[model samples]
Target: MNREPKAKSQEPQTSGRSDTGRSERAKRAEGLPFASERLTFLEHLTVERGLSRHTVEAYGRDLEYFAEHCHERGLALPPQIDEDCVVAFGPYLASKRGLQPVSIARALAAARTFLKFLAGEGVLPADPSALVSRPKLWRRLPDVLSQEDAATLCEAPEAEAQAGGRLSWRDRAILELFYASGLRVSELCDLKLADLDFQMGIVRVTGKGSKTRVVPVGRDALETLRRYVALLRPKFAGPKDEDRLFLSRTGRPLDRIAVWALVKRHGRVAGIPGDYSPHTLRHSFATHLLEGGANLRAVQEMLGHANISTTELYTHVDAKRLLAVHAQFHPRG
Candidate 1:
């Protein structure tokens, strides 16, 4: 552990990432404590697993942190990882990284996956993370918007859409698409010309793990998207824009951060309270549907949740609503 930081400290830094067979990122992974195994795992993640770049990057960081921790104990990951090492990782994350319980649990999950991968590869005899208890986190409900607030936010850009400006209906369309279909930010950005069916009022979204699902879009949202495509997207489409449904001023497809900034900007424009983000609209979309008597299975399908349990969080509603229902229906009261 003590010798590794020095070995890496003297190594020259490499800039720029390549997506070739052996990328710079993969090569850097090879420089980690478990050089070969880690590099192979990372390459597997990109080539075979087909994880998104962001997700793969996160997994790589997790492995790097674990390797750094191991570096503190030994020059590199030992022939075998014991349970004690996995247990120590939790405290290390808490004491050194100041990670919250949820974050720590997530990091541990990444480690567990890596360990399992190594075990399968015969590099490790068994998974050390198997016996470790992940931090038990409280079920924190997501923040949701009221119907009126969501509508207000969606229309906030209308006032500024005058005379076919630079933004035009693009921002409004972004918000509407989020609220209407409960699409994740990445799914929204990944949308393409072939994904939309205007006649059916649905959008085919490629979600996490490259899973695709058709989510119905409201008529209003479809209309806004149509207007944005017809008015702005034509000019925004560059030779390289491909068939992406959303684009920046430079005709490049919008990235996650750009769309998030757009959402927050319009949130302030709507004068809504508390911080607003793209996911807030998604949460609102699920909650409003459940409150409107939408079936749980249906909502789960719409949200593209692999598990119904994840979708059930919207069933919590809000404390105020629960109390009101209790007051109205409880006979003992």
Candidate 2:
């Protein structure tokens, strides 16, 4: 595996802070609940993934939120997470913090993705988020759901997982991975079997301009992917679909349009209001991470953006939430 290259300096300069001061902060971060892991995850994105500065900062905020949430609920480490913790966090974000459904969903998604990361890195025995479904947000609008409606949508996939069919398994795998890794429709359609690295829980993607990057796939998605590859893909595949990750009933590779249609179909079936496209999933993937405090550069890298400015477009999507924060905290407001 290719690792991040370290930089060499011609000259070294010392800051006013002493080594003891640096050690103290490191110790303090380690002592805090989930702080060390959070820092390591962010560093992985930075040094290992080559994510942009803005993306790293966003992830830092999201990790801090997770740490704070875990600290509040007395969840000191990954092992402490269970289905209840996952479920309860949603309500706490809603009722306690008065966050909108979109924000709440974003937070849960981030936590789910983060736990998957920990599990991949062997920090946890298994992915606790596997059984816990991601909270879905309405397209274009942050349409709020009744408590019951939210629960139903969340568990709908779990129910489907229990009553599995070849198509069901394949669809679930595709959808889970779409949100998990935030792949472009084209990138997703072009995926080959050889690209998946289950041990690392990542997929090597060739994005726009033929630039390739390896992105971490969340644990829950990886689980579904295993099932899809082992059982489902072979069922639908002909010689044409042999190497492709996704395929149609005719055993041909699926096109981008097919993926888009699948997302829309699933979104509607889940009772999610408004229309959805494959990019809708992509938008949600980036938006949720940012909303959860992912670094802007990390998101950009994951999305295979050539320029940081393109990724900044997602920040604009948070205008309302930004205004809400300003209203609550701004002295003049």
Candidate 3:
């Protein structure tokens, strides 16, 4: 990854520090119960996932609220969390905090995602989030490209690559890898040249919370990547480029924004509808894999999802398949 430029030294803060938005949150959450764990998760969101400042602060505040609730109840959390800890959260939100239904639901959702991450890290024995009843809102499935649409998008850059277009090789490789590996945009951008193992047909990805996973690269994407490395990458390599597998025209490592723009431009060229982004390719990758009868656990690991519950999201939306199974297996049927 391209190193962020160091900030110039600034004046030291006064004895009486002015605690603003994030500072105030930290000051409050700092002394609260479970502050250590909460701070670690917030750091994970900021550093690993590269979430925006406001977004990380939002999560920090929401988690602070949860911590306060637990503290008030004298609930023993961490090293173990059970249904009781999760079960009481909704009532505490509604009655004690007097949060509206929507606000309460949002908190629960955030907490659920957070807890799942902890569980995946083995910090918690199990995720207790599922014990609480979720607000029965419509589940929005991810925007997924059909296989034909995905093929069109992945193939869209070939003409440009063939015509000696600038960075077309890089673009082709990125698109193919996006479809093949089901990587989060952040994970994809974090990849290094050392991560790829063509002999093994795998790439090592460092994902959220600094967790690493190995995902198989399809033959097409792997071959394209080899060509990009041999033919194009050297041309773009700068002294500071280091081991980054992907580089910008300036020889700096590619960031998430570049990947998004690349996917959007290619989506338009492919004439696919609904403003697909890099995430669309990721969603499609998981969707296609599961639809191809890929095991749930395998997909969970490949996508670098902290929790299998997330991987299960792609499966749950297949209503027709669920119904077919019911009809086939039920004794009454």
Candidate 4:
């Protein structure tokens, strides 16, 4: 879902001409190209643009690298950056700087956004970044677990199914929900008791930017969740009235890192090699549905994709199965 950017608060002002004098001196010592302006833009992205903290830090780091590039070449400020300067920096990032294509592309996007912001603020006459092409990037498909591997991973937590294990029901529910719903780690973590409707087999997931979508939970997942709520969750509840559906051993909401570790540990038990995380379950969920002939648009809605194009990636993953069907039935084959 698209959201309007939030506005950032202006920098605080100090009383007296003495403070003003200090500001001027500081700006002079920092040179005409003050890094503070870049920081102001970042603040605007956070408050006005309503960008996530992760995005803000990434953009800041990208711009800082660009600023360092200008410093080495004796450029005064971002306003002085022309199209040729940007074009030169691209090669510098690739060849001299030895950054990968994806990294360079991200850095270029950051530079372009900064330039656009400068133009919008009337700091620059035109955005020099507009003249340059963004670096071409190869899309890497997400690693998906095979159907057997997915089942194995889900079953790994069942070893704790024996009585006296801590929160085994909750862990099992978490695994089942991830495979059944295709939720991002953050979306899963954000789930609350009120968001679930066991009778209706639906889960209300708040996705990126607080956008809410209701996703259907499979019978198995619903059953697991019911078991968790009924038997295990009370054991983990704290004095505070937290309504989170899933809790850690500490009775607090589970963070993404902990979720990652859990998935990784289960992957080892399942005998699946290489890196695997919560997102792999999501990918496996989507890919499995597509392979089973689920409609793309329907899956898109369930996955809470703002654009259908993002959901098309699963089509690519299921293409091999499509080819097999064609070979089996097509007269030409």
Candidate 5:
């Protein structure tokens, strides 16, 4: 795992950018440099854990960033990534890399996962990252469109269709389903035809970590999807592309970037202010449900969140709105 710590005089000075103006000191005396081990760990994540390509890539990027930081300090990745090094990594990402709290926390999470994997495989005596506590996140609430704005945005595609634009049914269904199901962009793009149960108004969605959940679809979304499949999907889907639920004009499954652009385009047309992505619809869906008195656990299950704490963040949003209303209408104020 890691080499024994040597005297400060014996440590070599390394040239690299560091968060602090002072040169970074190596936390550990010696350790194995990341090489084949990093690759094998990532491979295990993909093959054994069933993580999606996007998640695998994000983990790889975070690990690489950490590795570079270690190299600059004349240290190596775990078991060299000791408690002190792991502790400093959060601040380094913030001060040096200018990453926000959420991004820094995510990077640390990646490092922790990697260290745990190495420890599990007997590559290290113990997990160094385990001794490091996670950084506190700011918990910035997601931006949500108002109900009127959401409805207007969802209808933009159909309005275009009424003006004789092709692919309107597909776009409208995409918007409606996003609001109805709260599926992640990747999950929506990867949805297969068989994933939808229109008769039952439910869709089987595979979310982060490849966890699958069945979410109910509203009648509006299901009706739009039914029309799209019957009318537009067949026109776009080629012989080889019939399995996917959503297709491009070229018959390939719609990619995440396309969905992003479509959301932004329609948001502008509907005069919704500020940036909005597919996830905005998801935030709106969850917030509106909570505002309407839906149970917290129900929303968690619908969003396929692994932890209830993650879903609890929406409660904060409701609290903030209540404060605003109280301030505006209270007679004493």
Candidate 6:
């Protein structure tokens, strides 16, 4: 087990005034009814619902931004706010505040949730936020490697395998499983030794919201995993008999950040450009399946999307590729 030491910081400290100012604003904003209600909701999400701090903060920020927008519009406090007020706030955010479509949509979603909470608590007569429509924008397709590029990336572990003379099989297995199963980085890191069923060719994954699903492993991925388990993993296992499928050099479970760095390193080796990460492989997995004529429902199931709408992003990717092909070969000038 070889644990890398934390790298020392080299950059000089910037001004702290901006940080102090934001803190002050956050404190003052917490006093408002909107903010107070948000704090309560956040507390519920954390303590009762057991959501991660990252998710709580994201929801907090979204609600806080909407509350600030309402304040700017001179709308009466939470009790006085109505659907029309929220509807107007959308244009206000877009036209006057110059928020992007994604930002507006997030804010709207937050507001809807908060308003529903208020309605449930009998604080408001109705859920006004529900009336606010999310802004519609052309879906921005995810970046994915072509099949050749994906193959190149999967092969990148060979170099590391040869140089390190250890964990090469493990690295190859990780890369292969990622592209083959379309597992989210978190899901991949969470994998356990017991999750793989070699005979059945299935890997059980616990996805977002802690939902469990079984994904079939391709032949290449299964072979890679077999070799890794037989040749490399034993060398890295510690006395604890930890079940984690992927491990750090130090014989601990690999964390998400480490997985992200590994993906970037392999992308560089594969000549992939412009901020590629582990999710890029997941995106590639989905897009490549659609391009290969897989049905949307099947892709949705494999990707573990709770909603068909969530899976529809690949449709946009598929359309763009079709447009490219038509332009390249069509006779129309």
Q: Which runs of model 1 end up more than 4 angstroms from their true locations?
A: 1-31, 78-80, 318-320, 324-333
Query: Clash pairs of candidate 3?
Result: none
lDDT (Cα, tens digit) per residue for candidate 5, span 132-153: 7676767899988888898998
Instruction: Give per-residue CA lDDT, model 2, range 1-333, as digits (tens).
Output: 221111012112222344566576556556668877887787877787776454565566555566666778888877897777777778777776788887677667777777888999999988887897677655444222333443333334554455432366777787778777888787898899899999989999987546799999988889989988987688777765478888766577776556666665556668877655666667777877888799999999999887998788888776766898899999986
Candidate 1 lDDT (Cα, whole model)? Answer: 0.81
Models 1 onward score TM values of: 0.86, 0.51, 0.62, 0.78, 0.85, 0.76
* Candidate 6 local lDDT, residue 306: 85
Off by over 4 Å in 4: 1-35, 71-76, 88-100, 322-333
Candidate 2 regions off by >4 Å? 1-165, 239-241, 325-333
Number of the candidate with higher lDDT, 4 or 5:
5
Q: Candidate 1's residue-wise lDDT over 1-333, tens digit each? A: 364344233222322222353375566656668867777887888888887776777888788778767777675764656888788888888898898887788888888898989988988888777777777788888998889999999998886665334574888899999999999998898889889999999999988777789999999999999998888788878877578898776577777767887788778867999977999999999999998889999999999998999999889864556778889999964
TM-score-based ranking: 1, 5, 4, 6, 3, 2
User: lDDT by residue for model 6 over 115-203, one digit each (tens)?
Assistant: 89889888888887665567787767799888998888888878766655465577778889989999998899889999999999999
| Per-residue lDDT of candidate 3, residues 1-333 (tens digit) | 222121101112222343465477677878777777887888888888887555676687778778887777776567545678777788888988898877777888778878888888888887888667777755567888889999999998876666556667888899999999988887887789999999999999987656688899999999999999999899889876568899876577777766787788777877888868888889889988888888989989889877888888899655545687889999975
lDDT of each: 0.81, 0.71, 0.79, 0.79, 0.82, 0.79
Candidate maximizing TM-score: 1
What is model 4's C-alpha RMSD? 11.0
Model 3, position 274: C-alpha lDDT score = 89
User: What is the C-alpha local distance difference test score of candidate 6?
Assistant: 0.79
Query: Which lDDT value does model 1 have at 12?
Result: 26
